[model samples]
Structures are given as C-alpha cells and as structure tokens.
Target chain A: MSASLRKFIITRILLTIPMVLILITLVFIIMRILPGDPIRSQLGPRVTEAQADVLRERLGLNRPLIVQYGDFLVEMITFDFGNALTQGERPIKDELAEKLPATIELSIPAVIFMAVLGVWSGAYAAKNRKKPVDYIFRLLSIAVYSIPIFVMGLLFQILFSVRLPVFPLAGRMDTVMLVSFDSPTNFYVIDAIITGNWPALGSALAHLALPAFTLGLALTGVFVRLTRVNMIEMLQSDFITAGRARGIPERRLVYKHALRNTFIPILTLIGLQFAALMAGAVLTETTFSWPGIGRYLVERIELRDYTAVQSTIGVFAMFVAGISLIMDILYAFIDPRIRY
Target chain B: MNDTSPLVQIRDLSVTYKTRLGDTSAVDKVSFDIRHGEILGLVGESGCGKSTLGKALLRMIMPPGRISAGQILFNGEDILTFDDKRLRDYRGRQASMIFQDPMTSLNPVQTVEQHLVEAIQVHEAQTQTPDATGRIKTLLERLGIMQSRLASYPHQLSGGMRQRVMIGLGLVLNAGLIIADEATTSLDVIVEAKLVDQLREIRDEFGVSILAITHNIALVAEMADRVAVMYAGNLVELGEVSRIFDRPLHPYTQGLLASVPTTEINERKELYKMPGEPPNLARPPSGCRFHPRCPAAMSICSRHRPGLNEAAPGHWVHCWLYQDHPEKEEKTLKVAA
Candidate 1:
C-alpha cells in the first residue's frame, strides 16, 4: 500500500474516536433523563417504597447525578455494564457476551441473503428493463420494502410454521435438543456444528429460517432498487455504449462493465443498510422470541435497566462506526479516483 | 483512385426518430459511398444527422432512432439483413466506432490493459497470439501511449491519452473500417491536431478506411481525402476536399466556407453567418431542406428537390444552380475556374 492510503486509514480511525465518544455520552445522558425508576419498575407492587429506596441507594442511584454519570462513563471504557435489575441482578456484560453472538449469527445470514438476492434480482431487472420481467421485479421490491418487519415475520411464521409445519415457530432450538447441545460460541448454529451436533444444527437452523428470512426480505427491496436504478444508469453511460460498439457481448457489457461501475454506490447502500439491519433486529428478535442482544435490550428497557441500555447502545454505535470505516477503505481500493 | 470499388455503399438511406411528439427525420434519403482505403469526412453542424448517419452504417441505432428506410451494402451484401450473430461479427472485425468524449467513453474502473485485452479476446477467443502482452504493448506504442500507462485507470490518464486508448480500442481487432464520430471534438486544438495526424498515420500504415464525422470543416480539411457536407439531414455536396473547399457548388456549402476565418486573407473580412437556424427535422421545409437557409434560394429551389448532379469530374452537388441550363452552366464554369 502507498503511504497516502495508510495515512487515509489512520485518519479515519482517529476520526471514529470522537464519534464513539459522542455516541456513548449521548446514550448515557438519554438513559438517565428518561422517566422511570429502575427499582420501582423491577420490583413493581411487590416491594414497599422504603425497601425500594434501600435498593436504589445500594445500586448507586441515590448518588449525585454528576457522580453517577462519571461512574457510568468509566465503567463503559472498561466494558463493565453492572447488573440487570430484573434478571436476578445478573451481570449485564455476561448476558451480552452470551447473546451478542446469536444476534450476529442471525444477521450474518440475513445480510448474505439480502445482498445475494437483492443484487441478482436487481441485475436481472436492469438487463430486462422496460420489459414485463423488469416491471414484476420492481413491484416486488417495492412490496418488500413497504411491508413491516414484524408483520412479515408473523406472516411467515403462520405460513411456514403453524399451517405448513415446514419449520419451527420460535426460539433458538427445540427444548429437548437445547440441553444436549454444548454451545461453544453461544451461537447455537455454530456451536452445534463445531460439536458435531447435526441434530442440534438442524433444529437451530429450522428455528432461525423464518426470522432471518423476515429480516433479509425486508431489506432486500432497497438493494434491488438501488442496483437496478444504478445499473440502468450505468448501462446508458458512454462507456457501456462504447463497450457495445466494440462488439463485447451484451452479457459481458452489463455484468463486467456496467455492474462493476455500479458497485460503489451499491456498496455504500449496503454499509448503511447493515447498520439499519442491526437496529431492525430488535423487532425481529422480539417477534421470534430469539435470545439475542436486541431482545435482551427490549427486556432491559422495559425494566428501565439504564446500565444495560447504555452499554448496548454504545456497542451498536461502535459497530456502525467500524463498518463505515471499513467501507471507506474498501471504496478507496475499488475506485482509484478516491484518495486520501 | 476512382477505379477502386466502394467498400461501403449507402443508397438513399433514411433514419427517423419515432418520438412521442412526432417522427423526426434525422437522416433523410441520404446516399454516399466510402471507397477502399480512403477517408470520407462527413461534416455538418450539430443535430444535422451526421453522427446518426455514421451509426446507421454499423446498424447501431438504438430505440427512438431507427433506420426507417435505407440499404447499407458492404461488399455487395446488405448489412440491414444481418442477424444478431452476423452483426456482432461485423461490428468489431469489419467496422468499429470511436465516440466523441474520451473521458466518458472508457470504463472508469477498468485499466487500459484490460480494455484493450477484452477488445481483442472478445473477438478472437482461440487466438494463437502467444504474447498477448506484447501485442498490447505494440498496439499502445503505435498509438503513442506509454507501456507503463497500461495499468492505469481511465481517470488517471490525461484526455489525450484516454482518446489514444479509445483509438487503440478501435484498432485492436484490426478492423477494416473505423467510424470516428466527432472523435476529436472534445480535445483541445493541439490535441485534436495531434490525433488527426495519428489517424492519418494509422490509415497509411494499416491501410484501413475511415469515416471522420465532425462539424469542424478545418478538421476535415486536415484529415480527410474526400468530404461530404450535410445540412438539415441532406447531403448538400460531395467531392474531393480541394474542390469542396475551393469551388463549393451548393449555396449552403458556400455559406459554411465563408463563415470560417482563414489566416491566408489578412484583410479582416467580416465573418459571414448563415441567416437562419437549421430547420427542424419533424417538419423540414418543402423541396430543398436547405432552401429556407440558402443564400441563393430561388422559386425552383423551393418547388423541386434537386438530385445529385456531377458538376465536375468526381464532384457531386444537389442544387438547382447546377442543373442543365445554358446560362447557369456558364456561370458555374466561371465560378469553378
């Protein structure tokens, strides 16, 4: 690599430091300012007001606001998230370490599905532009993009699980199989495969199918439209016309020349969409009752678990910033016009 | 030179654009020939259908623009009858096209080496050319491009270099003919002149014919052996470059020549401007397409469209002024002398 490119990457990395800091500080403040007392919400009517006060004092909620804010920021830097108020005071870090991988496992496959299907259908639509095939693909993309994620998830469950019985309805694995399978990665599918647990793998994948599809299908529309519109524009470009004039076959012109040029914009969209998918996973996890960070976040938020919420939001912000940085580096590699 | 058979013959060709508003006649009943190993310059103002005519020769007209009527004969075979496969083979091997803007004519993501190699490999899949790299090196060298620039992307190259690469792409298949549709229009004056000189060298070295299309008459004078002037989708005059420049028969041609400033005449003569804009092709003027703009317009010019008449030994003009009239013939002879 050239010195300039290395410098560009280092600059981008340095820039992310301030971005992450701002994001963590904002989430910290937002969690604290929101109305609701964690002890009251967790204990509900079962605990008396005096007992709740005692609990709040023990949890450092009785401290001055500045002191609590400082403590929160310091704990974040050290990756310590204290404990969940509702889950028997289980350490938030341990819950996240166990659940984050499950979210990733589902998201990774959904993204793969979204990228592959979206790009393929998009290219097909562009090549057949102005024809019936193009119209059908375009309408289908619009339909998928407009549908609500949870609604789509529920629909899939009804069709594929309850009525057809082709797949399981909810959760990460069957109850009987869950006990026998040793989770090495906390990601049931990966752990199942690593331990030679084919039955567990089958069960985990069966349960994963509907929700992943729901998430993947919801995001596929954007990629399809992005690729198709960009591809059509690329096909009309002087280079593509020149390629055709050179007697390069139509397929090669569309795929090799037009598609390659269209990728930079598509890649930018994918990066933005990946961040969106991470957020959308919250609703998807809730619908399927899958044990992932998004579902865990919802549970913590309902119980006003401020520490857990702050940490989760911080982790999400970091993921988004990191992905965007990697995308910038990739842009430089793919298109030579971009430089430091 | 006159004895050589024409390589491509266009007979009464017409290309029309079927827009929703109306059908616009871009190339109306045009006829000409590009003979073997000769450069035929097609010169006209913008939107005069010169580029459409060039594209018509290769049957490369896309939607909204179609060759509504015409026959393009290549070696006695009408290319209009060719299928997709035959047209594909004919395009890069028999003839190819170079566009105007070199900056946008090349894929920004592809290197020059890849562009040239793809052009070659697309046509000759089972080639026995053992040294493909060497072949590309020679091709680039012939176009005055450096070997090191082969790995560079289009954005990395200068405009002149990119145009040279475009020229290299045109000649990579050893095509017999190249249609340069305003290829040098986007270059600076010096770069344009250099490219024209290189085109002349390529013609002589490779023995390939060219159809150089442009609105720049000066460019045609420098690069073309023969020139055809088009106005409002009509071929106004066709002749040897010297005759067309010296003794233009059509009034529109005369007007075009007068409008150009020449350094030879040191007396600062006012540049003559053609009085009217080009007629819209959707509803062109009656009789002669140039009649409304013709300086020497007459009643006959508006009533009858004159066919091409041979006024001098290899010079053809479509004008009523050249028709057989004793007095008019004497007047034309005096003008020619």
Candidate 2:
C-alpha cells in the first residue's frame, strides 16, 4: 500500500476509538436510567435489604458514580466484563467469544449472498430495461424486500424444514456433529473442514441454510434496486457510449465496464446496510434459535444484565467502525480520484 | 476500391426519436458522400443534427432514437443490414468515432493504454500477442503521450492529453473513416490548434478519410477540404470549402459564415447574429425547415419544400431562391400582376 493509504487507515482507526467510547457511554447511562435496579431485579424481594446491600457491595454497585464510570471504561478497554449478574453468574467475556463468532459466520454468507445475487440480477435487469425480464425483476425485488425477515425465517422453516425436511429448522449445527467434532474456533464450518470430516461440514452448512437465506434474501432487494438505478445511469454515461462505439459486446459493456464504475456507491450502501443486517439478525437468531450475539444480547436485555448489554453494544460499535473503515480504503483502491 | 468512388455513401438516412409528443426526426433524409482521404467538415448550430448525423454513420444512436430509414454503404457493404457478428467486426476495424468532451469519453478508472488495447482486442484478441504494447506504445508516442503515462488513469492526464488518448483510441484500430464529432470543442484554443495540425498530419500520413463535425466555423475553414452545413436537420449547402467560402449559395449558409468574427477590424460594427433559434425538430416548418430563420425567405418557401439542387458544377444548395421554379414563379407573378 502507498504511504497515503497507510496514513488514511491509521487515522481512520484512531477516529473509531472515541466513536465506540461514546456509544458505550450512552448504553451505560440508558441502562442506569431504565426502570429497574439490577440487584433488585436479579434477587427476589424475599432477600432483605441487608443481603441486597452486601451483594451490591460485592458487585461494586456501592461505589461512587465517577469511580464506577472510570472502572466501567477500564473494564471495557480490557474487554473483561467480570461476570454476568443474572445468567448463572457466567463470565461475560467467555460467553461473548463464542456468540460473536457465530453472528459473524452467519453474517458473512448472508452478506455475500445479498451482494452477489443482488448485484448480478440488478445488472441483468438494467441491460434488459423495458423487456419482460426487467419488469419481472422489478416486481420480484419489491416482493422480496417488503417481507419482514422473521416472517421469512418462519416460512423457510415450515416449507423446507418441517414439510420437506430439506434442512434443520434452527440452530447453527446438529448436536451429533457438534459433539463429534472439536470446535476449536467456535466456527463449526471451519472446525468441520479442519477435522477433515465432510459429513460434519455438510451438516453444519445444512443447518446454516435457512437462517442465512432468510437474513440474506431480506436485504437483496436493496442491493438490486441500488445497483439497477446506478447501472441504468452509468449505461448512459459517455464512456459506455464510447465503448459501444468501439464495438464492445453489449454483454461486456453492461456487466464489465458499467458495473465496475457503479461499485463505489454500492460499497458505501453496503457499509450503511450492515447495521440493518445486524438488527435483522436479532429477529433471525431468535426465530431460528441460532446461538449468536443477537440472541445473546436479547437474552441479556430481557434479564436486565446491564454490564453484558453495554459490552455487547461496544463490540457491535467496534465491528461497525471496522467495516466502514474497510469500505473507505476500498473506495481509494477503486477510484484513483479519491486517493487523497 | 477506386479512389474516385466514395468511401462511404450515406443515402437518404434518417434518425427519429419517439417522444411523448411525437416522433422527433433528428436527421431527416440526409444524403452525403465521404470520399477516400478527404476531410469533410460538417458544421451546424447546436441541435441542428450534425452530431446525430455523425453517430448515424457509426449507428451509435441509442434507443428511443433509431435509424428510421436509409442505408449506410461503407466500401460497398450496407452497414444497416449487418448482423451482430458483422457489425462487431466492422466497428473500430473499419470505422470509429471520437466523441466530444474527452473528459467523459474515456472510462475514469481505466488507464490510457488499456483504452487503446481494448479497442484492438475486441475484434482481434486471438491474434494478439503478449507484446500488444508494441503498437500501443507507438500510437501513444505519436499522439504525444509518453510511454510512462500509459499506466496513468484518465484523471491523472491533462485535458489535452485525454483528448489525444481518445484520438489514439480511434486511430489505433487503423480505421478508414473517423467521425470526430466536435472532438475539440472542449479544448482551449492552443490545444485545439495543435490537435487540428495533428489531425491534418494524421489524414496525410494515414490516408484516412474524416468527417470533422463541429459548430466552430473557423475550425471548419482551417481544416476541411469540403464543407457541409446543416440547418434544422436539413443539409443546406455542401461544396468545396473554397467555393463555399468564396461564394456561399444558401441564405442560411451565408448567415452562418457572416456570424464568424474575423480579424478585419471593421470600425465599431457588431457581428451578424442569426435571427431565430433552430426549430423544434418534432414539429418543424411545413416546407423548408430554415424558412423561419432564413433572412431571404420567399413567399413559396413555407408552401413548397426545396430539394438539394446542384446550383454550380460542384456545389449543392437546398433553397428556392437559387433553384428556379418556373411554374411556382408564374403563379407568384400572377398574384403580383
């Protein structure tokens, strides 16, 4: 990479620190103001005030506000959430390491599916313009985009899992495969492959199918519409006309030349839609019983585990910042005019 | 092909656009011939269909606008009837175009060398050796872009350099006819002058015919061996440049030339500006399209359309004033009598 790109990356990473910090701080404040005390919520009313006070002191809830805030920040920096006050008093970080990877694994294939299928179909539709294929794609995109993700996940489960038995209804993998293979990375697909166990890999992928598809298919419409509009506008550009004048095959003009130019804006949209994808993941993980961060976050929120909630949000903020940074660096590589 | 025979004969070609109002005929029954090795300047005001006519030669007009009639015969082959396979072989290999606004003509992300090489490989990719850069390097050098700049993207190059790269793209295919549609309209006068000289050198050295289309009358005079003037989708006057300059027959042609600012230094005289805009092509005048704007419009000009007549041996004019209509004249005389 050039010196300028290296400098851009460094500055971009530096800027994310405060962004994540602010997001975490807001969560901390909201959790405090929300209508319930953590200790009261976790312990029963049968427990006396003296017993509650002792547990509060143990959990550092009795400390001064500024001191508690300082300790919270320090703990966030170290990524050590001590222990969950509710969920069996499990260590928050230990639980997080497993759940975060599952969310990322589901999201990786979901993103790839949305980008590839959406971009390709959009370009195809633009090339066909007023034809029947174009109109069909236009209608299909609207139809696909309007259906809520949770509804789609339920539908997929009924049609593919319950009725046809083509896939597992929920979760990341079957218990049989989970116990058979040693999941070192907590990513079943990776562990299955490394173990050279093809059946385990197949089972893991089969279990992943419904949730990933529902998650990905819900977002494909946005990419399709974006790529379609951009491709149509790009096709009218002078370079495309010039390319046609040179007798380039219409296939190459629409798919290769015009599509490449449209990607800078598409990359920006991809980065923005990532947050929406994560929001959908919460519903997806709940409907499918996938053991991911979205489900974990929901469980913690229900239990009013304040420490777990804010830490979970902090990790999300970091991931979002990292993705946006990657997108900016990608823009510099795609468009030379943006190198500065 | 014989030198005397026209290289490309455009016979009664028309291009129309389907608007909500009606079909707008941009190029109307236009017929002309570009001879081998001749630089024909096609001059007109904006929206007068000069660029449309240029694109028609290459069949580059997009949808909603299409060739409604006429045949384009290139080297005796009618390009209008060519299938996808033949059309691909014909473009860039036989004829190509250099568009206006070089800034937008080349892909922004693509390098200069990549533009030229793609034009060649589209038709002849199999025969292309690894050293395809051999021809590309030589062409860039001739266009005044250095070998080092070959890897540079369009944004890195200056405006003049970009235009030259466009020119190189057109020439790299060794095409016989180059339709330069206002190719230098965006350039500064100095760069335009240099490209003009290089274009002339290009014609003389390569023996390639050119249709230099622009609104700049002065540039047309400087470079065109023959000149064709279009007014409101009508080819009003066409002849040798010297003849048209010395004695323009059509009133619209005369009006166009008189509007050009010369270095004569006439005392405090304002330049002659034409009276009306080019008509809305969808609903042009009933007869001659130029009648509303013509300085010497006759009473019959609105009622009767005039054909392009050979007023002199090698000069053509489309006006009732020059082409005598004895029968129409008698009727007009009786009205006066």
Candidate 3:
C-alpha cells in the first residue's frame, strides 16, 4: 500500500525480465559449447559426412552461430519452437505437452508430501526441543539429507516396486484399462474423474503414490531443517513474548505469532528448493522411466540432441524464474515489512 | 490512598539462571510490595537485577532463568502456583507487561488495529462491548497515532510511535498492575520524557498501580511515587521518592546517586562512575557484594553482610555502616538519613 512498496514491486518485476533472458541465453550458449553434434548423432555412427552435412543444413545447423542464435531467439519470441532434429518433424511443443504433465505429476505431489510431513516434523521438533523426539527427528533429517536422491530412488524402486510388488514398477498406467478417459486437464487424476472412470482414477493415484513418496522422502529433510531453524529463532522473538504477555492462547501464539514470522524466509527457501526439485527430477524420472521432462532431457543428452537439451533447460529455468518472481510478490502479502 | 492491602506482595523472591558453567543468581531474596495506585520505581545499575525482579514478579522468566524460590502474591493469591492456562487467564486480566523493545515486542506483520484487537479480545472476550473497535481507535489516537495508522504495520511507524503503540497495547488489556520493564529505555530522551509523563498521567487517570523499572534515576525521580533500589540481586533500599533523592541511606544507593550526573550543572563535568563491575552472582562476596569497591568499607563490612533495616521512619538501608555498633550507631545512621 505504501509508495515505497509499490516502487519495490515494480522494480522486482522489471529486474526479473533481464534475469530470465540472461539465464536462458547462458543455457543456450553452454549447450552449443558442450561436445556434441545433434545432426551427426541423429544420423548414427555409420552415416557418411555428406549425409550428416545434409541433415545439419536441413536442420539450420549449417548457419553461422550468430545467425542461428538470432533465428532461434526470434522463433522463441513467437513461442513456436521448431521440430526436434532427432524426432524428425515432431515439434518441441508436442514433446513438452507429453512430458510436462508427467513431470508436474511427480514433482507437485512430491512437494505436497514434503510440505506437510516436513513442516509438521519441524514444528514438532521445535516444540519439543532438547527432548528425545527432537533428537530423533534431527538425526532422521540428517540421514535423509545426507543420502543421494538417486541412491534413495533406486533403493525405493528395489524395495517398493520390485521386492514388495505392491505398486507398478514403471510407466503411468497398465495396458488393459477397466475404464478409458480423454486427457482433458492433462492430469490423469482429474481427467479420469471427469470422464467417469472411477477405477482409472484409483489406479492413477496408486501408481503416483510410490514415486511421489520416494521423492518426498528425498525432499522432506530440507523443509524440516529450514522450518525448524526459522521457527526456533522465531520462538525467541519478542513478538512471541508479547503474544504470551497479551494472554493469547499458547496454540494461537505458536501458530499465529511464531509460524507467520518464519514464513518469509521459509517461502524464499521453498522457492529455491522447488528449483532444485526440477533439477533433481532428471534422476527420479530416469530411474522410474516415468516419461517426464527429466528422462526426456536425459535421453536427448545421451544422443547429443543439443537443441532439445538447451531448450528444455531454458524452459525449466524460465519456470524457476517465473515462480520465484511470483513468490517475491507474494512475500509482500505474507509479511508487510517486505513491501519495500 | 488509604488502601493498606498490598496489590503485589513479593516475599523472599530469588531467581537463578542455570548457565553452562554454573548457576548464577539474578535476583537474590529481593522482596517488596507494590501498593495500589502507586508507581513503584525498580532502579539499579545495568546488571543489578531490577529487570529480573520485575520479570519474577510477573512469573515471566525465560528458560534457564528459573524462579528458584519465591512467593509473588497478587491480590493475596500466589501466582507461582497457577497452572499454564490459569496463569494465561490471569496474565493480561490482572497484570500485563510492556517490554523495552517496542519494535520487536509487536508483530511487525500485523496491523496496529490487529495488535490492539488481539489484546482487547484476549482480556475482554466475555464483555458485551459494542464500542471495542471505536475504543481501540480512540486509544491509538490518544497515543498520537492517527486513524490511518490503525491499518499500518509496526514497520510503518517511527520508533516513538512504536513505543506509544506498545504502551497502548499494555493499557488496552485493562490490567490492574502494569509492569513497564525499561519501557522507555529504547527511546530518545525527549520522547522518553514525554512518554513517561504520558504514562504517569494515564496511571493517575486510571488508578492503575505501575511497576516502572529503569536504570535511569532521573526518569524514576520524575514518575515514581516510591523507589526501590536493587544491588547485585538484593533489594537494598526502599523509600518515598523524596526520601530516596534527598536522603539516600544505603551505600549502594549512594553510589548509584553519585554515578548520575546532575542536569542543573549545564556545563560538562566528569561524572562519577561506579568503581568496578558488579561482582559475579555465582560467587558473590562474603560480606557485602559492594564491599570490594565501597570506599567506606571497614573490617566488619568484609566479614559480615548487612540486612535491610529501618534507618528512619520511612527510609530503609542495607549496609553495615548503619549497623547497631555502639561506637557509631547513633551518629552513622542519624547523619546518613
């Protein structure tokens, strides 16, 4: 509401535009520098130089670096990413359309799992600080945080999918469907329910549960530690004391005074963690063979699909920047002090 | 003024903090009564347990700083025996506290109206008061904040304004006894003077007993009706304001008085500083805590501690200098008063 806050929001929004462009440009340049030729790789090792050159020319790779970059930038501005060299006439948008939903399906559920479990654990640990429960949660967080996500994903795959055999090993759904549905919202859960496929909806949730939980386990420690540290510090603040002095209920003080103050920092951390989650999804997606962007990027990278690699990374970077910007704007709403 | 029942009766109250090294006494057997409608000044040096005593009275000591032993009777009911819920119920309804840091004492994320409304709702939840919002707005206006500030956050206010908001928060609860622990220590002198004057006026208007805790003797002199001086962890002296300034009897009280520079001097003069740092509470001196730096220390002063005893009709002193020594009893106690 203040003039300074208005100026600050405008400045933050303006600053984000250049940041997005620079990050995308950097990803674009770095992809070119990495050792690989998309056209040559697509032609395979047995192809002749003549064939590779023809393919390269056809794909616009024969142009000068600046001209190629300029053309790509212009195309990107129009939101019409050209066909993938490897896919041979398949547009990048089509690949994204198939892959983005799967990635969101995995990541969004994982984030929700992390937020609920992690925040509760953190709050509990802070409330029972110095006790056995606190120590146990602290050690659990440390162990979870120390283990590599890929290793944990493999372990979960072995235990939950292969050994126990309670859930599907890989893929979004089974072949023989008791009920069929159109992908209206691109999310199976919503689309199945919309099309009146109750069994399909149930199956979809069951399929999502394991991978989501696995990834959630990987992420929970981060939120736990972040919220724990912030909440502990917030508990000592004079505002909490004032709340107590005002005779506000202990539960109210804990929720209102303590947790709310910790939100700004927690929000900033959550935004950073979401970006990390996108990067980490490559491993989870590949391990599970879930056909998400992570696996798409990995498979493309193996075949040296440079344009696909660069564009995918660029899109993810843009997503990260956009979400963070939105969060920074929301920061003003969460904490009035952040308006400026 | 004729009410003889002490609003707050603290007896043999002692607080100790359990540090990693050892237990340190923050308030040692410091006891005093706050009479109704009277402003009692709890004055001492920075580490002299004035704030500790005030907090102990409210049963608000934080972790590790436990009230080792005490009886703080508010309205003849000992508050230390109350459970958490009961204590909370009694906290703002019967007593409330205003902290030194107004900026931090308020939730910066909340609006002024939200803060006041919370306090009002906490204490007056059962009251059928349709004028609650109006009353809050009027209180803020009286505290010099405009109607627009009701919707403003703590960060939006100036330091003086934040302090006024904190004061308004303490009073809005309508507690019988208000403990202001160095409430104006964070403000400019002029603002502090204005606020304290405003606080005194509010006190007079509402007939609320106030425990005004500050290290500034001058501020205490201006606002408090009676003064209690603490040293280390002891309540060394208590008397009427006039007696405290005009006839301080205790050696520690005299040292505190000497340390303060006279404002009337106008020209800059070398102020008398306390001779040494306060003794460690974990291992205080054998005789008197002030004996190490006391210029008037005698052989007996190093061997035996003194007790708080009546030196005059209303003045109390805690030093061996006014002891019943046949050689100097009459003259020493008489001259000091």
Candidate 4:
C-alpha cells in the first residue's frame, strides 16, 4: 500500500467515530423524548406506584439525566447493553446476539438476489436499449419499486403460498423441524447445512423464500436503474471504445470493461440500500412473524422498552457506519484514482 | 517498398450519420490507398471527415454512423464484408488504431500491465507464451516508457506517458498497419515531437504502415512521406509531401500552404484565412464542396463535380482548374440555352 491509501483508510475510520456517536446520541435523545413509561407499561395499571419506583431504581431509570446519559455512553462503549426493561430484565446483548444473525441471514440472500438479478437485467436492458425486452424490464422495475414491501410480501404470500401452496407463509422455520438442527451461529440456514440437517435447511429456506424475495424485489428496481444508467454511460466512454478496438469480445467488453467501471457507484448504492434493507426488514419481519432483530425492535417499541430500542438503533448505526468504511476501503482497492 | 500492391485500398467510400434531422454525409465518396511501409498523413480542418475516414478503414464506426457505400479492401479482402468475429480478429492484430485523447482512451481502473496483456491475449489466446510480460516490457522500453510504470494505473502516468502507452498498445500485437487518429493532438510540442519520432522509428524498425490523421500540417511535413488533403468530406489532393508543399495544385491546398506561418519570412504577414465554414453535409454545395469557399471558383466549378484526376506524376487533385476542357464553352452555352 501507498502512503495515501493508508491515510485514506485512517481518515475514513476516524470519520466513522463522530458519525456513529451522532447516530447513537440522536437515538438516545429520541427515546427519552418519546411519550412512554417503560416501568408502568411493563408493570401494568394494577401494580402499585411503589413497586414501579423500585423497578425503575433497579434499572437505573431513577438516576439523574446526566448520570444516566454518562452511564449509557460508558455501557455502550463497553458493548454491555444492560437488561431489557420489558423482557423480565433479560440482557439486551444476549437477545441481540440471538436475533441479529437471523436478520443477517434474511438480508444476505435478499441482497445477493437484488444485486445479481438487478445487475444482470440492467446490463441486458442497456445492451438491448430501445428494444421490447428493455421496455418490459423498465416497466417491471418501476412497478416493483413503487409497491411497498409489506404489501408485496402479503401479495406474494397470497400468490405463492395460499394460491399455489408452494412455500411456508411465515416464520424462520417449520416449528416441527426447528429443534432438529444445532444452530451454532443462530443463523438456522448455515447451521442446518453445517450439521447436515438437510430437512431443517429446506424448511428454513422455504420459510425464508417469500419474505426475502419480497424485500429483494422491493430494492431491486434501484439497482436495475442505477446499473443501467451507469452501464450506458460507461459503454459510451472512450475506454470502452478503445476496448472494442482492441478486439475484446462484446461480452467481456460489457461485463469486464463497462461493468467493472460501473462497480464503484453500484457498490455505493448497495451500501446505502443495505442500510435501507435493514430498516425495511422491520416491515418484512413483522409481516412474516420472523424472529429477527427487526421484529424484536418492533415488539420492544410497542411495549415501550426504551433501553432495548436505544441499543438496537445503536447497533444499526454502527452497522451502517462500518459498511460505509468498508465501501471506502473497497473503492481504494478497485480504483487507484482515489486517494487520501 | 511494394507500391504496386497497396496494403489497404479504400474505393469510393462514403459514411453517413443518421441523425434525427436527416442523413448527413460525413464522408462522401472518398478514395485513397495506403502503401506498405509508408506513412500517409491525412490532414484537414476539423470536421473535414478525416477522422471518420480513418475509422472507416477499420470499420470501427459506431452506430448512427454507418458506411452507406464503400469497399475497404485490406490485402485484397473487403473488410466491410467481415462479420463480428472476423472484424474482432482483423482489428488489433492486422491493424489497430491510436485515439487522440490519451486521458479518456485508457481505462482508469486498469493498470498498464492489464491493458497491454489484454491487447495481447485477446488476439493470441492460443499461444502459450509466459513471456507476455517480457513482450510488454520490450514494447514499453521501445516507446521510452519505463518497465516500472507497468503496475501503475493510467491516472498515475503523465499525459505523454499515457500516449506512449496507447502507442505501445497499438504496437503490442505487431500489427501490419496502425491508424493514428490525431494521436499527438493532445500532447505538448516537445512530447509530440518525441512521439512522432517514436512512430517513425516504429515504422522503420517494424515496417508497419501508418495512416496519421491530424490537422497539423507541419507535423505531417516532418513525418509523412505522402499526404492526402481532405476538404468538406472530399479528397482534395494526394501527392508526395515534397511536391504537395512545393506546387499545390488545388486552390484550397495553396491557401492551406500560404496560411501556415513559416520562420522563413522575418516580417509578420497577415495569416491567410479561408472565408467560410465547411458546408453542412445534409445539403452540401451543388458541385465541388470547396467551390463556395475557393479563391478560384468558376461557373463550371459550381455545375460540375470534378473527379480526382492525375495532374502530375503520382499526384491527384479534385479541382476543375487543372482540367483541359474543350467542352466548357459548349456546356456553358447549353446551360444558358
């Protein structure tokens, strides 16, 4: 590596610190300002005011605002998001560790599907611009983009589940097959494959298919449009013309020469969309009854679990920040034009 | 030099661009031949279709720009008839082009090594030579580019170095002919000189034919053995460089020569400027496209389009001034009647 690249990496990493801080701080402030009483909401109206006060004291909610804020920062720094206020004081860390990977499992396949299908169709459309096939793809992408994810999920459920009876309608796996595999990573699909539990793997994938497809299809339009536009621009570039003059095959010219140049912008979009996917997962997960962090977040928000909400949003902010950093590093690796 | 059998023969070639407005004849019935082991400098003002003609030789014209009528015979085979596969094989192996802008011509994401290796591997995929790197090293060295620059991306190199790399790419296949379309137009004076010297050396050393397209007459005078002057999509003059410089037959050629600022004249003389812009190709002038702007235009010049006729030994011009016409008076009387 060059000195400039080293400097660039250092700068990107340093910039993330303030970005992550601001995100978490905003979440902290928003949780406080929102109309909610975690202790009362959890204890119910029948509980005595005295009992509520004792519960608040135990959970550090009785402390002064400054002391609580400082403690929250310190605990966050230490990666110890203390017990949930609504879930019988279960540690938020443990809950997240169990749920986050399930969310990732859903997101990974969805993102892969989005990228592959999106880029392929986009390139095809660009290559066949002004043709009937291109027109059809354009219209379909627009339709997919306009529809809401939950609506699409519900519709897909009806068409592929109720009507055709092909896939499981909801949840992470069949209840009967859930205990058959050892989930070493808490990501049932990978764990199922690792333990040679093919039935569990099939069950997990079948349950995941509709929701992931719904999420993937929802975001696929953006990639398709982005890649199509970028690919067209790159194909018109002089380098692509030069590549053609060099006798490179048309396919290689499109994919390697034109598409490779389009990657930096496409990668940027993917990074942003990945963050958006995590946010969208809330709707998808809720609709499907999938036991993921998104569903956990919605449940906590409903029950007025302030600490759980804060910790979950904090984790999301960190994930987004980390992804942006990784993308920056990747840009440096792929295009030598970028430097510190 | 095998002058009898020209390496590439372009016969009555015309290229038209299908714009929304209408069809514009960018290149109109242009014909010329490039001899083996010789430099043919194609000089004209911008938009004279010189660059289009160069691209036409390789059939590299992009869409909306089509060869409406032409026969580009490369070694007796009409290249215009070639399909995509054959065209791909023909380009970069038998002939290659060097673009004018080095900055935009090279892929920013690709290293110099990647560009050179791809140029080689695309044509010679069946060849099992691990010495691809060795060949690239020698080619760059010959072009005055250092071996260390191979790993560097195009953005890392200077403009002149990049131009050299472009030339290196053109030469990597050991092609029989190279069409340099204003290849040195973007370089500085000194860099241009160096590159022109390198082109000459490559021609002499490798016996590669070159068709240098440019607007610079002085560079052509220095480098090209023969020159073809184009005007408004027509080949106005073709002759030995020395003869064309000494006794220019066409009025446009004379104007071009007189307009060039030479150090021989110590006193400052007013630069001779051509009066009008090139005619729109959609509706070109009635006869000679240059007649409207020509200093020596005649009534017949507007009515009759002059064909390229030999004015001297191995010299051709498309102007009526050189034609002996006994029928001129009779034709004029007939037009009046």
- Model 4 agreement with the true structure over B195-231: per-residue lDDT tens digits: 8998999999888999999999999999999999999
For model 4 the interface RMSD, in Å, equals 0.8
Q: Candidate 3, residues A102-216: lDDT per residue as tens digits?
A: 8898888998888888887887788778899989999999888888888887888789888998888776766576235567567787778888888888878878887788788
* Top candidate by TM-score: 2
Q: Output the TM-score of candidate 4.
A: 0.95
User: Measured by TM-score, how close is model 3 to the native structure?
Assistant: 0.92
Candidate 4 deviant stretches above 4 angstroms: A1-10, A45-58, B1-3, B325-337
| lDDT of model 2 at position A338 | 87
Best-matching candidate per lDDT = 4
Kindly indicate the candidate among 1 and 4 with the higher TM-score.
Answer: 1
- Candidate 1 local lDDT, A45-100, one digit each (tens): 78887999899987888899889878877877788877766668889889888999
Task: Indicate the residue-level lDDT of A263 in model 1.
Answer: 80
Which residue pairs come into collision in candidate 2? Answer: none
What is every candidate's C-alpha DockQ against the true complex, given to 2 decimals? Answer: 0.78, 0.76, 0.69, 0.74
- Model 1 global lDDT (CA atoms, 0 to 1): 0.87
Q: Clashing residue pairs in candidate 4, if any?
A: none
Docking class of 1: medium
lDDT of 1 by residue, B1-337 (tens): 3337788899999999997769999999999889888899999999999999999988889988899998998877899999988888888888889999999999998899888888888888875444566788988888889989989999999888898898888888888789999899899999889989999999998888999999999999999999999998999899999999988888888888888887967786688888889988998899888988776676767777888889999999998887853323233322211
Q: How is the predicted docking of candidate 3 categorized under the CAPRI scheme?
A: medium
* TM-score of every candidate relative to the true structure: 0.96, 0.96, 0.92, 0.95
